[model samples]
Target: MANAVPVADFLVLPPRLDRTAEMLAESARRRGMAVEHLSSPVVPARLQHSAGGHLYGGPTFAAAVAPDLDLVPLEPADDWLPQLPYEYTHRDIALTTLGEARWSRTPMFVKPPRDKTLPAGVYVDGSRLPGDERYPADTPVLVSEIVTFLVEYRLFVLDGMVHAASRYAVNGRLDPAPLDACAHRAAVLDFAAGLLDACADSLPSAVVVDVGLASNADRGDEHWAVVEANMAWFSTSYAANPDQVLDVVLRAAGPRHRLTLRDQAFTRPPTPFPGTGRSGSSPMS
Candidate 1:
């Protein structure tokens, strides 16, 4: 359904991800849908021009604050995630520190949280930071403690259904290979449920579960833990075959619940940036 013609509605990114929203829109139009793309207010450019604007027939389009957008509910029955959203540190520090441990493993995993996904190839460890490039003295870097794991998996859920699943070894060192289709499905289901429970208000119409290698990261290499929750728009199914994932996104408009976008503000207590210090730090501000 998502692919069949933009279906006379406007598609939009909630608080961010303009490029992604555009791509999804393009795919829909190609299938004969006429759609309009709007960036979320997270983008200054979008926010600047958001006020006093309108779009297609579906809903009022605006790059307003996240609270302003009417998102759909993803309420789960109970606690879904085995643990909290994966707490990750900087990749450079994660890699650099883990390297010091001499991991007997091969495929090491590295992920930066959604708030900081940028500058491609910036591994979790400090290894990615250039030796010469002086980071603003005020910038602070967060890195994950090196961890070993066993199985790796990916889950795709659309409109609350387990649409696609895949398993990976992620280069062997991580030992997430020999994908287990069934295990991945269950993991994804659990994750999707957790997302509904944890982020019911922010529950988007769609989402993809990026289950971490289900190995114990704290005990042995076979330990399993939740890695991080990623936005459906930001995640890519390494093995989303049959491509039904696309159609699900389209049909989602059918009886799909829409969360009212509350016009509020994202007031995060000011924190120091990466590198430098408050008393004597460089300035990017």
Candidate 2:
């Protein structure tokens, strides 16, 4: 099966309990397949196969174990969702080193380049970031204009097509009831398709793109916007079909990835960064 790489060919080594990897493993076992879980963080020298897991500690851990294993391609947080050419579903955002944000006393959404321990939130000024001391004072971060998303969906994309999608959140909560997908299937799919086309060259062959309505207003002028892109291996599946999500996961960060994908998902090396409490491994994962 194209999606059925032997469990032995992959490793499960999430920093903690990664429900998505567990679900995939369990589902594979139900189908008479075998998978293994490595309790230790250290990957053996001889190990050279795909692994499925999430960043429990930080990117450094993934970076540490990557060389010894063939885990799904974990793109750098900063590199996964680069600035888009136009304001599709994304708001105005900028990336800069912490030093550059020192004097800025404006309210904005600030977060690490990738998901990390540091919480991403609105800070009145760059100097007020709570956990900035945990990382080097000069760590990089993303500063974006604040925007509200009434509803959000996670789309599993492979080869520029949305294979599976689910309504993951609503009004700042985990209400994975498919409200958005059910009510706006055409709009969501259409918007995702066009946005994928517009940003295809900037994204990985397999990844997760989060999209949401920009406004609660019932007007044709209102359109969906890009929330962000995430590494399939580390991202939650939400209410998306497990089988379809698994297919995407396998293709996104599977054994075949070495030949078909880029060496490093990010343009730069992993730096000391944290995540906003809003993102990372979820209960559904």
Candidate 3:
């Protein structure tokens, strides 16, 4: 009989590995996949020539190596959150250019929708946004009303299901807990199901969605709201099952040729200059 093919030829990590990356590497090894931690941002010629595999890293690192490795990194659409129903978002969200956003003088939560080039926070006003000199005036950003999250949970979703979940924060502080032990596990899953049913087309089959219990100051009530959707490969698993997280990561960033038609729209466009590499300074989380 012929030897069976491995799920992936390699599970690639960025040069500066983190505990999450190390943990994922161990998980990959246990699944009979070879792991490669690049020495730098540059993709080795050998890896570029070999059968492609999946990459696990942040946007910066993925941008640097994805073209050379032919990996397809999946991400949520820029307007996804803004288009979500108010029940799911619980806050006013808008997609606008940094140039236009600079005109706002009121407090608002602003962030670059697709990348971390701009610091995401509740800015006192538009003047606090990074100068147009640093980022292009036309850089896309998400502007939303500020809402405090009492707790935040990360759900690793596959095929519109919450495959694994972990509570990552409480009252804006890091506090990782497995979903099994979480008091709101049922509510979280239920909320996620409603969200997927409403707008699964807005996301890739494999992705991470963060939901939180938002405190509505005026209403004096707390309700579930989606914090945001993030690339599964770039998200921190926290206390989520490594195996389940890996399942999503593999599909989120894998050989480009294997990409499904539905996911084609979600794939990060290939870098124009595939050979130009940048430092892998970004964290996996």
Ranking by TM-score: 3, 2, 1
Specify the poorest-scoring 10-residue window by lDDT in model 2: 276-285
Candidate number with greatest lDDT: 3
Tell me which of candidates 2 and 3 scores higher on TM-score.
3
Residues 1-285 of candidate 3 have per-residue lDDT tens digits of: 332333447989999887778889999999899998898867766677345578898787887777667668888888999999998998999999998988999989998776777888989898888885777788889999888999999999998889989999999999999999999989998899999998898899999999999997877889999998888988899999999999999999888788899999886444444345432222222
**What residue runs in model 1 are displaced by over 4 Å at the alpha carbon?**
1-7, 10-32, 35-111, 115-128, 131-142, 157-164, 168-184, 187-205, 216-218, 241-244, 247-285
lDDT of 3 at 66: 76
TM-scores, all models, native as reference: 0.44, 0.77, 0.91
- Alpha-carbon RMSD of each model: 11.3, 6.9, 4.2
**Which of the two, 1 or 2, has more lDDT?**
2
The prediction achieving the highest TM-score against the true structure is 3
Query: What is the C-alpha lDDT profile of model 1 across 1-285, one tens digit per residue?
Result: 111221233344443334335455566666665453444323233322222211211111221222222222122111223224443211223322223322323333433233232232324444544333343322333234454434456555664555665664453343322234445555546655665466544333454555554444454444235444444433444545424444534433221233223311111222343342321111122
TM-score of candidate 3 to 2 decimals: 0.91
For 1-285, candidate 2 gives per-residue lDDT tens digits of 133232344434454656776677766566554454556546544454334422222244454554345443545356444467556834667887666765678877777755554577878887787644565556777777777787788998887899888988888788885434478788889998888888776777777888987663334245578877876766788778777777776665544344353534432332322341221111111
